[model samples]
Target: MPTDVDLGHHGDRDVAPGLVDLAVNVRAGAPPSWLLARLTGALGRLAAYPDQSSARAAVAARHGRPAGSVLLTAGAAEGFVLLARTLRPRRAVVVHPQFTEPEAALRAAGHEVERVVLAPPFRVGPGLVPEDADLVVVGNPTNPTSVLHPASTLSALCRPGRVVVVDEAFMDAVPGEAESLAGRSDLPGLVVVRSLTKTWGLAGLRVGYLLADPALVARLQQAQPLWPLSAPALVAVEACSAPSAVEESATWARGIVAHREHLAEALAGVPGVDVVPDARGPFLLLRTPVDVRSALRDVGFAVRRGDTFPGLGPEWARVAVRDPDTSDAFVRALRGALGQPAPAGDGGRPVGSVALVGGGPGDPALLTVRGLQLLAAADVVVADRLGPTTVLDGLAPGVKVVDASKTPGGRTVPQEETNARLVSLAREGKRVVRLKGGDPYVFARGWEELAACRAAGVPVEVVPGVTSALGAPAAADVPVTHRELAQEFVVVSGHVPPGDPRSTVDWDALARLNGTLVLLMAVDRLPAISAALVAGGRGGDTPVAVVQQGTLEGQRVLRTTLAAAGDDCARAGVRPPAVVVVGAVAGLVAG
Candidate 1:
């Protein structure tokens, strides 16, 4: 797992080998010690096509189900593809913030995909669907933001002709296996897909399975080619069916849940963050004032961005929880970036327009080229203490620097007044820097300011900066895009629930992705974030880290898994100027 350009590992370069991949959920080592013993016995016959009936029966016995209920797949992603292809429901309503492959497949098959939204804090709305859609699909312990809905809620969505396909690729990490719908038999039109890639580190082998009614399974099976599963993959199935293997997996599940809680608590202690509360899954949601993605990258870490989901945008990201050491290392790298200096202040022009600029965390060095140009053109600097103070130095000696920074303990001006000031300045012909940290597009309240400026007939332009979610993780030397780890990245906020109009982050769609997540402004929400991830079905022990003052001096890192996230942040004393990363990239710190 050492840095290798040949494999396109995170942080790898053509000139220099880089990264011992952690973002990839697969294990660094080959077959586990116990599993190795099974290779000789069950895998010796690689000369011929695998016996499909026996291999499937092995899987059925382990789940205590009939063979008719199971259908082997070439990884769970294909199950969704198959279901999407085979099920010709009148309408396809997919839960937002879940995996997109299903929807994509449905679209390719000429079905209309309707989205159910889960915005911030990743909670579902009061009425999910019209109850009229015939084919519906979702994932438990949803991806990206890691918000897991309860099984009862998922069961309620199941009805005749309404194929509720649940992706449980991560369900093995949950200890109370009883909560999963896959083990149940009564629900009709219920199809469940699971992957051995994440649970047993067999992604390359490409082995997965589906469980549903015999009729549904038969229809799906007919669409796939014969010998859909490779010989080695079938061997893996036979090996995983052992009782001992299941018990060992159980132990790992318990550990993940415990670690997720611990990690969440550690993040909560950090200031200026809103960690999603009640995170029961392995990964938690995070919210910060800065652009989390750029912040992590600038500090030497890489994380997934949450912008692609139906309801989610570019302000969020996802990380994997690995072991303890890498998690801690990630935090230290972030603290350095957060404390990086901002551009210095200069004189004002008093011209008649405004440019709302994002600072991209506190680091002036990490600012986008356009942001720098806008900073130099600013006639007035209206900024808060949270933005890097050094950015003021970028201005001319006598630029009008309006200290909008609020008192730590005294009465502060209302946010409404601040908006009014920007509008007034622009109307008076002054080029203003409505300088907020991170990208103005992400959680900078730019939407409101733009609305206000337009409504007032004041000319306005927005200059975007690197979001801190990416910047902070970069400073920590983590790479979100290891070709082997994942195909997509998601960015999101960690503050309020996705369904809440007041929230800036997309909670629902993030809960459904097969990508990575990066969070911002999530210090206090660590506990809730942790619980949401666990409940969403991300492993409780997924690696997570909080970086305080990334890309600058005084960088402090708190490393832990999702279960222990809360406590670890507390122990490390991480404060407001931190970016939280939850994914396999966090584990790269040690590499």
Candidate 2:
């Protein structure tokens, strides 16, 4: 049909709060102090409508065109809408996978648009466009693809009856503004659109301009509303077009070149990650083996999804170029997402390594990005029953899975055997993953496995998971530590009763503390534990909550007082693999 692409989806949608944004291509820390000062000073003039004469002239002079040839717009986006409304063409074509706004704007204005989807190395040529197409839209240093088409190639698309609109929105980010068509006035029907948003980091300001023949500019202007741009936006347009601002952008463009190269080189080295070749823009297009956007998000980084753009699929992503330090860290996180290990050190360990990953609160989605990566790369996985077992379904067909589950009063995989298996796998030059429930070190005997791997001289790493002790309480809407209720939380093993000789915990001491108590593996011992707390001066009526199968589909919460916790849990058929929270905050959520 009509390409089946989400034309309205942009990179900004890929970003969320608490994430390092690599999705949006806008330069970070933009609108330098000087530009900010100019815009700030213009705020006083907002009482009056904006005057575009000065701004239009400034843009005209910057590109060596007459004032009549420049049309100041609210932003490059508005320019697309203006052109889409003003131009009447029998056949309109848009080149992909570039910016989608042009096609979207045209479609929104009740116009039919065709797409010339380019293959890898996305280089455009005159042959790609149909001769009968009267209107064509393309981007120089295209978005998502980051491929910069030659100026001659774009000019070749222009003819007497055909209109070739070149979007140079990101041209300023390219060193020396290479391959730009803003100054080409002799080419008939050539309209060059330039935006100040990306380089100036003024995306919120909405300032840009289009350069075309005087007649076309006037026609487009007629279609725009009066006072189309704000005063501050008008000031930004004039100030950014100044020669001094141009020179400053040139310097920043050179810096972008360096940062882009650093990011490209590092990404090229990551396994299963393919960086699109010859990236000329400030961002790079990446093709990954699987859709790792969620994994990357889990790791606190946000990347633009490529499937929204025509000619690209879900496996493709767009990441912005950042400083070398940030690029390096991103590369490392990327390696984890792809289940690859860090480069070997001077110690020259074998390619094989062991990673202890926490599966987190029984939900596969709750697993950390690093944990997912290790599991993906593992040749052998030793997993616990309480961990995210469903994740094993996604593993490669060849991966070997071992059940190391421990059942109460039943068959169990010995701790000693689990440790030996990890060491043996690594020694056999296998990438081994020891996956456990919650935090691996939280009463999981993960340290013992680490010790065994180290004793065997096998390189090892740990990817901490969300421990159920805390995750379970939160999932049940029970705050372990509340300012007015409890300021501290104590997590302890409840595998043994209060008076059991094998127990290491001092029940009386724990009872004396007025804080939240989180007990793991304590369902069978709740009677003795509650009695000990009550006998040790703690109130019997203290609130208690048991969260079973926390974060899983079958998760259930049983609420009661400490004195009745044992009977209530027994009657409710509560089981192990649950977190028991004891404190005033436990009863905050009503049954």
Candidate 3:
């Protein structure tokens, strides 16, 4: 650790004027537009003294508790200071690698603070703290490490005389608030402080609240001034605590899970970067070998230094989760900072190069090296739902991910719109990658994207992938072409029924062929296609194989005869995105 470290140093200090900021845990985008409007409306109330009652009731109701049990603070940090000023503890223990405000507050108030630093993975337990300590403060889904402690673990810290304070400032970003203790009123001497700063982008307004028994709330209240929160801050708190706002917060939390996963995987891919595996917070903790924070700043990124946290050293850093584009950009900068190979395109500055990159099947490792390189180098990626999503997780955080997935029976973006988006992005001098599953040319619409880019004067290149037509069959151990049973093979789409006007497949010609037949997207129309083959003189007992979600963890394979393929598929509840093979060779492999 550095000797010149400031114990009070925070993420805000790491941020500069124009960097891709991954330092502060504050939400990336602005507060909800409606929230801002509410605050704007409250501006008229400025003439009045601060009224804390309504906001207090709203917070209480949101937590399913009485109004008396809640105490609104300017922020959770202020609540820590109030606790320090009011509570007189003989032995105070502050958990390390957590938010420093509580411990800093206690120390400033002349209390001797004992540090309880948990090891890596940083989960809290009852045995780690001294039984004699009368005061204990810990952060749930703690800072820097982003580990969410179980509610039972926190509850175990409570004793008759000991007051356990849980900082749940980031709990709102956890889906379902699963490990939160904020709503638990049965625990003895437990105080939960929550902040709206992270989820609602309200750091500047400083709105937060404390939940505890009425008696403790009164004691903490005594240490505060009368007009602790301004009028607008009060309105902000009440407005955000409403039912609609709570639901929106949950949605945001769910989105954070995806963003965090995307950022974590990218960071993990970089050499010398070690990401904590159990991150549930909206930020990630990374440890690198060579002071990547300073190096990152040189590459236009500002990351929070972790040395100030008692249990962390200089090699560690904390980064906030951002939307995909910002995340991709940060990951690219990080790779550059770490001295990794420069991404493709001139001098790593992506120009008008459009890469029709194959995402392979469902597996990330199946992606060709060049395809992965192009992905990392791309400024924009228009992705399909069935593409190698695992590869997306490994992309640079700054890459723009445009979901052009055409989900069946669900809303889908038009192909023309996706084409226009790719061309427009390329026109803006971005390196755009039209990422698709399997081989981009094999039933994945690669040529359409290629033609669009070519017409738009964008330099486009295609990186072929391992097509699932063969990959899925091979994964299921079914050979599309066998030495003795089948001499040739054919692949066709079964997305449309046999008699549909859009259907071009020659079922009779396919049936007469003495070889294997591989059908893609054939699950829904399997029954119709199988009957067509049988009626076209294909033997009823010809073997059939259905492989669903092939090459993935939940993959399933079913074996039957061509005559019963449809019934068997229906009986087994087979779904789309499956491959069906019919021929004598289909029986060669065990399902």
Candidate 4:
């Protein structure tokens, strides 16, 4: 068993910037727009003191209990604290691998807390619990393990003069709310603490309630501070308890079950990743190498650690079951972190289609919504050096990564071979993502690959991304076009020298224009191109700015005139994958 010192540690602390969150198990997106509107409407009422009666009645009605049987608290966590303060149990027993707040609360109030650590499968049995324990706290569809104890097993723990607290914070995520005691009013000493936070995506609002005997509810209510529930929280309590809200929750719960099963199956197939069987919660419990969590974090993923829970070790982790796309992305990251090979799945079905996804400049955050979705679903990701490869760190387990970077003067995978690989993978029924840097169409020869795919009769989807030619200037606070400074902006490739017969850009015409010139793939040719502009009637003193690896952590920005732009870039050894801006707007540094 692990030490109890960090029993209070929660999942939120595992989250950080740029990481795909599997640590916190809140709903995927924001609270629904209607729910947001409801919360927003309640803000105007904050001037008044909280009125708990309406919320109490709503919750009671939702649970099919008397209004007197409900006691609203700041959240389920606060309800645990209240129980610790109010109940004077002769023996306190808490189930292991469950939410730790109840046990922590008990210990804080000077009670010697006993832990009944369940073994694998984590099912609660009569012999496992202490018969003499007067108080027991457990989570239905328990956290970190996602095991749902039968309601009958919970009822058996309710002895006379004893209080049984069931934390069902995630029960709503389980389809049918199976094995949940939230609506059970016939049982004695059964206190069901329910959170509106997870299902409503209102963790910040802190609204929850406990359902128990009216007498016990009154006793717990006595321990609460005056107006413990906020006015807006109360409104949430009421709104979420409405019949329509309950129906919507049930629908989401069903969807969650499907997503969880899909995620679990995929994870189970990954080498070195084990999904706990019969998981019924919104999150899945996984067992892997002890170092896997930190490794995931290093690759832009945040996953909850399991060591804080008693009976679990450093090898354990909890991952929220999200939509299929995100689940796919997460699984890929897991496999990459573990260095595992692809899993063998059913061979009868045709593999999925392919998408040429734009990875968007150098920043993973700039990936388009559709691109992210397609990337998540990809079974094989053929990535480029210029694309945001960090996102590949979040790919689902069993995903194959093919490096297709076309480095000049360096050994690289031939374009034809890459195209053939993509077509073959798609024909084999794999969801393939040809991830490229910036917008695939912006000088990426993506149209050529798309043409090959169409010729081979392989289905393909093109998801556009933020081009660095535009993203770079914006990142450096240098606008390509500024009002009264530059009226138009042209983005052209600098891969070919100005005098090269293959070059399509007319240097003379470009120099004759007064608009901005944004160049991509031009770092190596900067000197020739700058001189060509100077010789073609363009002013030698025209402002020029070079942004290298723009929007990335190692991004660098250089400012100089057109005459010195090429010479200065060469002197500084600026690399390719750089964006160059030339025009009056380049000189207009934003304040």
Candidate 5:
């Protein structure tokens, strides 16, 4: 009963205003003129209660079932809740990563639901479900996974005491409705739930029906309210189940086959993207090295987040099929988000590109998603010593790793040489990643590389990371600013001694302020800096804390007063890349 997945999350939540929606599986340009006309004509009959006689008979005739076997509801969702409330199965099993409402409804009704999560390729068969499960819920052409289970496989799940509930919500989207069991009345304890929401685009109308044996249908109908379907909803359901509407839906379903293939093929061609094979639904299930949902949103598209499903994680996303033009644009945006170069006009080959990525304080996990994507697609990585160096070990074979680390008082790569290399590699048609430590703009000289790439006419992107200046102090449990102690915090570089001619900082002004002062690259000149601040009308007893190698292994923290900071750090052998915090908040954490 305790699970990490949020069963109530649905695809419509992913859509936002002004975004191209590829999250919901509803067919585009739906509720054709004919169906809309019928619903509009029925609106005048709102004075009368909804009569399910004609709609129920139409659905029964459509599936070759008797009227007693049909139970029309508000929607397929209502049908799921009705069943969850009515069934008293001792062992209930839900096959996922499919639609989540069944599990959610069962749990809401105080039923203990067990999940039979199918693995990748996401195929469903007989032995996958528990033999003792008296109630089984599955989706044909499942949501998120988009893998349609064979009719034979699902039929094999039926037993004398078991209730096999098959959700065929999107089955009408399948050409010829192949693998559909809607008309199979001979199977024992079989319940087929169908919806016109996706293909007919009547989701707002809330029209659907369920077919089962007469006894089971009567039991579920008792759980429903009086005249459950609305007058307009009943009209929509009756119109959608007609023979003419069925033929029209088949034509639309055939078009989806082509559109889905086009989108899947284009996405599969993208590096690091794995498409779930044999996707028979109107959407696709995709897995990538990094979560690209946010990246895709940046380019004006909304996709379903797959983590809400039982067996999927953040790396998975579900994208609906659209027209060829929309699919092409989506693919281009996806390629850009994944750090792959845009296709050139000639032969679709990738063009040269450069990305300035912030690797975040020495911790690979702290790297941004955009940065990780660029690293995965890079042909050349120009890395700094303080960056997440360990992550480079996971790069694919044949990826050229260039050492551009700046060592204090040792051999170093010149800034000019590094800039030149970035432009040169990009000119050679290589995807170049200029990886830096911490926030690239936070004393990392990343603007220089951006300028060089721009001057050389190379397409470039900048991905910001967590800066060590703030991360280090927080890692040591020291807040740079405390509401009662210090209301403001200033971050400054201490590469130059306080009194040096090259120093741009005004030590006197800093000492006059009643706030926290965070110093970076100041370990070597701590004695002079501390003395200068003390001489400038500042208390020698001001609290000071030093954090070294923040957010990584081998991190060290030292707490002292301003007067004793230099002596304490010297005795403790504190080194470069440490952040120094001065003010009352520095002593908030125990020494």
Candidate 6:
């Protein structure tokens, strides 16, 4: 398919036609040596009927459930298909901001499927679920943006006749197995779906299972194809439960949690991206200023967009948590896409071009190559209060330096008035440079100024700055991109400006965006922020970073998030001129 064509979730990650994928959230690592050996050994036996006996026993022992309770299927995808046929619910409800396959499967079964869009940041509240749903399908540590719901929350929906299916496909990636509701027989009508593909990299083997009462298991088993699970899949099930494999999985899980936090922090630092916190799974959801679809491909990267999922709009994307090298590469490409900026007042009439640039966080070093280029070319400069003076000092001795900056409640010119002066000066034909801290497009009000210039017939161009979220991690010596951690990043405002309805903020999408979250001026509402993230289904103990005076000396970086970030900042005596970045990325400071 063409790059512009809608290839769905699988479309963006194709590096070469049908190869090199980063789209699916499976673990980056290859199958274990033991599993490989088992598959090869099993290959000889495939000519005959498969061995369900040992495979079922191995999985049952691993999950600590009876063999009868573990009904193996070809893959997790098949689990959804089987359920759609077995239960055949008249009206099915699928929770949003997660995977689409289950919903699609349900719809395909000729079932009238209703979608329950998760609340912002992505949580299933009481109001969203339909009153009379006979079957409800949901993914835990969901796909796209991996949001893990608590088992307690899952228990609430369990009823005698209603089929409460929780997909624990990503649970193995989380730190503790205690969080999963799988194999719990006490909950009537509880059907848990699990995938070996994600944790063990077994997609080719096509092995997945269903967890429910024996009767319900029998129901789904009846719907399976003859010899549904392959001989290799049976061997994989046995190998997956080996003591060595179990221990190795635990180690990988720990790393995934740590890496997820690190990636979140890195994304939080990038300007024009919003990464929500408490995402415990191995992937994240990012909301980007650049149309990530085109921009990601242009930059030698690919990711899943939110538009395809119910409830998530077009601007959002789902990314896997990759190693440090890939994340950095993605960030660099993202910077390129957002490089298009227009200076507030000056349409660089005859004066050498005036480009407004965001320096990003506190580290001037993180400034994009383009930002540095424009600065070197400027004959005259105007700067904001937060941007470091040292950055201006680096300018040529012959270049004229002007401070057209502002402080809160200043008698100095308002942003609107200051822009007027810039356009007037630029009209005189002098090389004018207006430098701001962070990417200018973000809450910097660069757009408002652009609108003003357009009205005045002034031409303007913008230079991309490395925002504090990305820079804070970089300056703190943390690599936001860790191959073992995050694959996606999201950046959003800390708080909306005055007169805007969302100036207050909505915790749903921000919370549901399962990645790192970077906030600008978000300190005031820390409690609400934490609650929102928690409500959006983020974990409470996720790492956070508060970077004050980023990229500049006296830079104070306090680490905390959501509920506790405000108190931590207060104790550390951190104040404005600070950017708040919350997520696993904070933990990525190099050892």
lDDT digits (tens) for residues 1-591 of candidate 3: 123446789999998854556889999767989998898788788899988888988998999999989999998999999999999999999898898888888988999888899888788777899999999999988997899998888899987899999999999999999989888888989999999988999899999999999999998888899999999899989999999999999999999999899888777667778898889999998888778887777655788999888888888999889876567667777777778875453264543878888777687878899998888788888889885887777778877788999998998989879878887788688888888989989998777777565444456788999999999889889999978999999999988889764468889999899999999988888889989998999999999999998888878999999989999999999887789999988899463
Residue 346 of model 6 has an lDDT of 22
TM-score of model 6 (CA atoms) = 0.56
Question: For candidate 1, what is the lDDT?
Answer: 0.68
TM-scores for every predicted model: 0.54, 0.60, 0.60, 0.62, 0.59, 0.56
lDDT of 4 by residue, 1-591 (tens): 236548879999898754667889888667998888887778788889988999999999998999999999888999999999999999899999888888888888888888999888888898888888889888998997999888888988886788899999998998778898888888878999999999989998898999989988888888889999888899899999999999999999999999999999889778777788999989999998646987787655688988888888888899988877567657866887898754554333464677998888889999999998988777899999887999888899989999888898897888889988987888788889999999989988788677556434456788898999999889998998777988998998899999875577999999989999999999999989999999999999999999998999988999999999988998898987799999998898655
Candidates by lDDT, descending order = 5, 2, 4, 3, 6, 1
User: Candidate 4: TM-score?
Assistant: 0.62
Query: In every candidate, how many clashes are there?
Result: 199, 0, 8, 13, 0, 51
Better of 1 and 5 by TM-score: 5
Report the CA-based lDDT of candidate 2 relative to the real structure. 0.88
State in Å the error of residue 240, model 3.
0.9
Instruction: State in Å the error of residue 159, model 5.
Output: 1.0
Query: How many angstroms is residue 80 displaced in model 1 relative to the true structure, after the best TM-score fit?
Result: 0.9
Model 2 weakest 10-residue run by lDDT? 343-352
Candidate 3 ranges with C-alpha deviation above 4 Å: 1-5, 342-591
Per-residue lDDT of model 5, residues 1-591, tens digit only: 456988889988998754677898888655788777887788789998878899989999999999999999877999999999999999999999999999999999999999998998899877788899999999998987888999999999998999999999999989989999999999999999988888888878888889999999999999999998889898888888899999999998999999899999888778899999998989999998899898887766788999999999999999999877568767877887899986563256444888989888888998999999999999999999996899999999999999998889998999989988987898789999989999888999988787566544467788998888888888889999888999998898998898664578999999988999999889999999999999997799999999988888988899999999999999999998899999999889565
Candidate 1 lDDT trough over 10 residues, lowest sum: 5-14
In model 5, the worst 10-residue window by lDDT is 342-351
Candidate 6: worst 10 consecutive residues by lDDT?
1-10
Clashes of 6: 51
Which structure is stronger by lDDT: 1 or 3?
3
CA lDDT of 549 in candidate 3? Answer: 88
Model 4, runs deviating above 4 Å: 1-5, 344-591
Question: Model-by-model lDDT, in order?
Answer: 0.68, 0.88, 0.86, 0.86, 0.88, 0.71
**Candidate 4 minimal-lDDT segment of 10 residues:** 342-351
**Cα lDDT of model 2 by residue, 1-591, tens digit:** 255878888888988754667899998764688888898789789889888899988998899889999998888999999999999989999999999899999998889888999999888877889999999999998987999998988988889999999999999988888889998899999999999999999999898989999999989989999999999999998898899999999999999999999889888778788888999999999999999999887766789999989999999999998777557657867887889888763233454788999999898999998888788788999898888999999998899998988999898999889877887777678999888999889999887777555434456788898999999888889999988889898999999898764578999999999999999999999999999999998899999999999999999999999999999999999988889999899989656
In the range 1-591, model 6's lDDT, one tens digit per residue, is 122223235523344331223466877657877677777777678679986888888878887788889889887889988888777686788887677778767766777777787755776665567768889888887776677777787788877668988988888888766569876888888888988888988777788888888888887888787788888888887788777887888899998877777677767667788875578787888888756667655434566666777676778777777765456445545655778333333243353345787777655666778878878988778787765456787898888887766665464657767677666666677667778877788777777555444323344678777766677656666455556565556666765533333355556766666566767666666656776677778878878777777667777678775568768777877877766766677666644
